[model samples]
Target: MKLVAGNMLWTNINKIPNQYNYLNESITCDVLVIGGGISGAIAAYYLTKSGVNTVLVDKNIIGYGSTSGSTSILQYEIDTDLHGLISMIGEKKGVKSFELCKEAVYDIEKIINDLEDDCDFSLTECFYYATKASMVSSLKKEFDARKKHGFHVEFLDKKDAQKRFSFPVEGGIYSKFGAAQIDPYRFTHALIAKAVKNKLKVYENTEITNIYPKEEHVLLETKNHFNIQAKKVIIATGYEGRKYIKEKIVHLLRTFTLVTKPVKNFNGWFHQCIIRDNNDPYTYLRITGDKRIIIGGEDEKVGGINSKMSNLSNDDLVSNKKYELLLNRLKSYFPEIKDIAPEYQFSGLFGVTKDGLPYIGEYKDFPNCYFSLGYGANGILYSILGGQLLRDSILGKDRPELELFRFNR
Candidate 1:
């Protein structure tokens, strides 16, 4: 599908850092990754690190898909709140899910450090506040849950919250750990580049037209009519890979975002940390390393219904009114930032799973094939975990946590 549209902030800011050749000839590998976005790059990197013969391919230019359009806000918190998630699943698994993502955040830092390229990665605090007074009790319960789970967090009431932000907050959770940000486009390219040095093959503009799963291996055919045979395949194509599965796991949605012009001051944006509120369809804001504001929210389901949404493919269904509303919301939050205007406005297609956890494991029908779909707001972080889990799964390691995000679950 058309993963994203409009002037993407990341790709527009970063020079097209790297490029890969399209698959011109048939090839074979131990593992074939069917996507070259951030998730596929990450999964390939992990496989290559383990000395597995891996090849990654994408139908579009690498990192030019949803990766470029991503706001790239990294956090341990699931899109579902802590208390809410605990209520959905059991407390243990829910907490572990968040912890896995927390570990993924550091795993990302370690990857960047090993590459010796920052990719504009940074560690930052995150604030989640309640918009109306009615939400304070629930917000407090969320804060307490985090605190009880040994997370470094502090509860802030309306008085303390107002002291920090330009907007009002009836209550908030200020987390001191496991939050970060990055230029996802740059990071995706960096991972592929490094993996190439370690003998990982990457091909862009290579479309997989058909998949033939055998008892021993799977064969994939590119649109160019070349055949790629592999012992295993990893579908990291985000929501697009749903073509291979019959079960419904996620709903497709488009999120609106805009990056503001650089400002000399943030007004009351405390620490310029990542900020989000308790608004129904929450809005998120964070300061880039370059001093611009990256804010996004106002998600709308594609086709506005489940049955119709499944038919979406490369649909140019972006809304101009959503962008305008998002821009106005940013201004409402920080009205004092003079001359502030969105230099870039964009929308991206994403999938949100019921429990806000990525699907990372083997499927029965797609035997010898695995899915590492990081379908949530914490896409990059989940991708990191997907890489590790898929690698271990391939290596015959037992991971019980996989059940939490199992296809059957």
Candidate 2:
């Protein structure tokens, strides 16, 4: 479980035009968004589309934060198992929360289609397979819960699953709906582009240093000593919001991924479906359009950083060793592919909440401030839903989903 700390997939997408200069003068907007990752960008996009004057600022280059590190498997299936969720939050709330995630996947597809974003978006079925005999009962229980909650799922035997997908598995649960894969960078860039085209102000490389709530508005201070005043402020700064949330439950964990050179025999090994193992340090595999196999997993908590020597530079042997292990695992699972050497290896960190659900909605103490954090693996979908929810709340409209994702709930 060596953790890597870079994003290879997002680094290849088109870059958005950046405004590197820091905010030097005070400005006013209907809404101010912090963090330029997928969540912030989508929030600005939705707010602007609603004709709300919006300003978005990021500490670094837009999409360079946790969004870039995402494996981008846009599925409603969360890091927490359904049975666990039901046990923790009662069946009614648990089922409702799961429905929100299910809706998020469909909502994202509609957004991409309606906007006609050229983000390499594709419809794909996501599969969760059991890698050990001990996991079979849990998998079945999850599958049954999904079915009871009205999700489209099918349980498959090892032979049937192996016949359809080349990956090694003991058994699996396939959900035909509520899943997709997209180039996250392209998606973020597209949203920012559209938001800019609609006259939303996006300031990249403009880091916010502090935020203070005013009588009727929120005041944001930046590293360069610039101030911004907005009626509503949204913090989508990912794990960096630890200071504001003041909760250690938002733990940071790193995950590694490797993309191999395009293989002609990819069809024999994969069928464009997203695959994940039902294990702790679970492995997820997907085939890109160019037939490159993208294998991701090997996650470790941030405290485990020393175990893998990830602190070493990119060309150092420590880095090579991490990638080597990932490649070896890929070969072990899909032995039919030759030349399994990876073309690229990268890693990134994400924040996880104690309850394993993203923190969304407004801060109880500060009415004008909204927070979106702790989207462990489903950041893309949550960002979309969060953006819409934040916008609705800011405009004084009712959003029923807010109850489940609120920060102080």
Candidate 3:
């Protein structure tokens, strides 16, 4: 699959800080992690830190997959709203999912601080606004659902929202201290570098062609005929990991993003909080450390690269058109910002599950193999949870939270 295309902001902004060698001969490890994006990096970091002999490999350079295209908006709020999730999986499991994600945000902060390099990590506030007046009631219900669970949130009416932000919304949920942002590309490389110093083996430009799960261990064969023997394997391959699962748990969604040149002033935007709306295919905006505004949305189901889903009317939904639409929406939201244009724009494929939670445990059929598929808008945060849970699982410890994200569930 073409995971990403167009000029990516992260890859164009920063180059890889460290490099690794490709596999030249046969190798063996206690655990093997495939795909060197943020997911694989997280798995390797936790496993190696726990004294597990681990090896990580990527077909291309690290962070070049979905990580590069990622907007990297870290939030506890899943793509499924709290109210919807409660309806889907009951109140207890639904709230627990958010709690796990909220914890992951801080855990990620700790990981970034522990590393030698700073990846532009910052704590921020998030606003879930209702764009249209019709959505106000349900949005209020969402706010209540969150508050009922003891989350720190404020219900904002139209007047309250306009008082803070320049854009006027009908109403919204204002959440504080449960969101963050980061340079995923830098974070990935920095993590792998630190893990390497602690005995984590990393191989780049090495593609694993076939995976064989045996009685005691798993053997991975590379395209160049090199074999990797491991007691366990982690398929942190993101959306591409779909090839291994029989059931269609993850549906690939095509999303667009536009990053603007740094603006001189953020006049109307208050606190530069991450802004998202209640639209089905919602529009979201975030401010980068460099003062650039990233406006992203317009999700479409992909039938293929050139083909759209049966619903989309236009066959020519090209990048340029999407970029213009995004820019127009930005102007509509915050008319105060001026003379700003996208410095970079791109699209990428990401996996989303029906219930808006990631699949992060061992599949029964693939014994001794774990899958760390963080499939949703909160992929980075879930990757943190995945790393923690998989670490505990490998150490032969039991976690009740693991059942919530199990493959069978």
Over 1-409, each residue of candidate 1 has an lDDT whose tens digit, in order, gives 4567777788888888777889999999999999999999999999998999999999989988778888899999999988889999989988999899899899999999877468989999999998899989988899889888888999999899878888878899998899999988889988998899889988989999999999899999999999999999999988787777888888888787888888788887888899988886889999888899988888877754453332332223445677778888888888778767878888778788888888888888889999998998899998998899889999999588888878978
- Lowest summed lDDT across 10 adjacent residues in model 1 is found at 307-316
TM-score of each: 0.95, 0.92, 0.97
After TM-score superposition, the amount by which residue 204's alpha carbon in candidate 3 deviates from its true location, in angstroms, is 0.6
Candidate 3's residue-wise lDDT over 1-409, tens digit each? 5687778899998976888889999999999999899999999999988999999999998999989989999999999999999999999999999999999899988998879977989999999999899999998898889998999999999988888888878998888879999999999998999899889999999999988899999998998999999999999999888889999897777788899999988888878999998897888999889889999998877765455442223224576788889988888777888868878888888668999999999887898899999999999999999999998988999689988898868
Query: With candidate 3 superimposed using the best TM-score fit, by how many Å does residue 102's alpha carbon deviate from the native?
Result: 0.6
Instruction: Give residue 82's lDDT in candidate 1 (0 to 100).
Output: 84
Ranking of candidates on TM-score, top first: 3, 1, 2
- On residues 1-409, what C-alpha lDDT tens digit does candidate 2 reach at each position? 2223543666664555444455657799888888887888888888888898988888778787767766788888888877788888788878877788888887777778656475777778888999888888889899899888888999998888778776667788887888888877777777877888788887877888778887799888888888898888989887677678654556666677888888877544445678889888888888766677888877656664464433534565655676788898888877777767677778766567766788888665666788877467777777887888888888889588777777655
Write out the backbone clash pairs for model 1. 2-314
What total of clashing residue pairs does each candidate reach? 1, 1, 0
Clashing pairs for model 2 are 6-347
Instruction: Please give the RMSD to the true structure for each candidate, in Å.
Output: 2.3, 2.7, 2.2
